[model samples]
Target: GAGVSQSPRYKVAKRGQDVALRCDPISGHVSLFWYQQALGQGPEFLTYFQNEAQLDKSGLPSDRFFAERPEGSVSTLKIQRTQQEDSAVYLCASSLDGPLREQFFGPGTRLTVL
Candidate 1:
């Protein structure tokens, strides 16, 4: 019934700290997506899940980045060994069952590593 929502709208993590970002997609949505947006750049797809299965995760920058949609409605993106370069906005989006590619995005979780 609600749109996608992400926790910790802003986060500050020291270098090497691990972080977990959460997302709650709209109920009944068939598709969920996670994106990373760097300053002054377009968002990059990190992963995509349909239902409880992760259909694609080719965009994850490294092995440290992991995503899961265990129950198909809530998703989490975990980043291990946070680095300064990992600072960016993590955005979550969800889409309904349709032929067109359309997704509603969350406000984004801004992570800043010091």
Candidate 2:
């Protein structure tokens, strides 16, 4: 895809189930980010990866949440033991350099944990 692309645009999971969300960023983009957006709130940063190195993950809410960009092009966000609170829109974005530059966002994957 020419832009950031996320799979499973919508997901419904049972409580305590594990889920993995995939993100394919724009070709050659160096910066990738993961964000979580609640029903009425804006997306909140979860992590940031520059190339294949994860430079920042302080925004991740808990140890159950993990994100990685192994090869710098594809990224994945995994949520273990999904809780009701984990339900939200998981967004993926990519920029040419860093967050300071304009980011291209993908259609977020909406997760609903019941």
Candidate 3:
């Protein structure tokens, strides 16, 4: 794709269900990041991957959240045992090298836990 693209622009999950959000970044981007955004707040960083290596996951809220970039291109963010509090927009972004570079953002997957 020309830019970052995310799957399932809108997702509805029942409580306790698990959801996986996918992201396909620009062809050669080396940095991928996952973020969670609540209705009225800014996006919060969840995790970061640099060319298939998970470099930082300190921002993840709990054990239920997991993100990976196996080949440094496509990435997935999984949320386990979804709860009402987990309802938010999950965003994915990619940069050329590191966090310092400009990042391209995907449309984001909005997950609603019912």
RMSD of each: 1.3, 0.8, 0.8
- Sort the predicted structures by TM-score, highest score first: 2, 3, 1
Over 1-114, each residue of candidate 3 has an lDDT whose tens digit, in order, gives 598999989999999999999999999899999999999999999999999999999999999998888877899999999999999999999999999999899999999999
Residue-level lDDT tens digits of model 2 in 18-98: 999999999999999999999999999999999999999999999999998888889999999999999999999999999
Off by over 4 Å in 2: none
What residue runs in model 3 are displaced by over 4 Å at the alpha carbon?
Answer: none
Q: Which segments of model 1 are wrong by more than 4 Å?
A: 98-100
Clashing residue pairs for model 3: none
- Tell me the lDDT of model 3 at 57: 99
| TM-scores for all predictions | 0.95, 0.97, 0.97
Q: Per-residue error at 76 for model 1, in Å?
A: 0.4
Tell me the number of clashing residue pairs for each predicted model. 0, 0, 0
Output the worst ten-in-a-row residue range by lDDT, candidate 1.
94-103
In order, candidate lDDTs are: 0.92, 0.96, 0.94
- Cα error, residue 43 of model 1, in Å, equals 0.6
TM-score of 3: 0.97
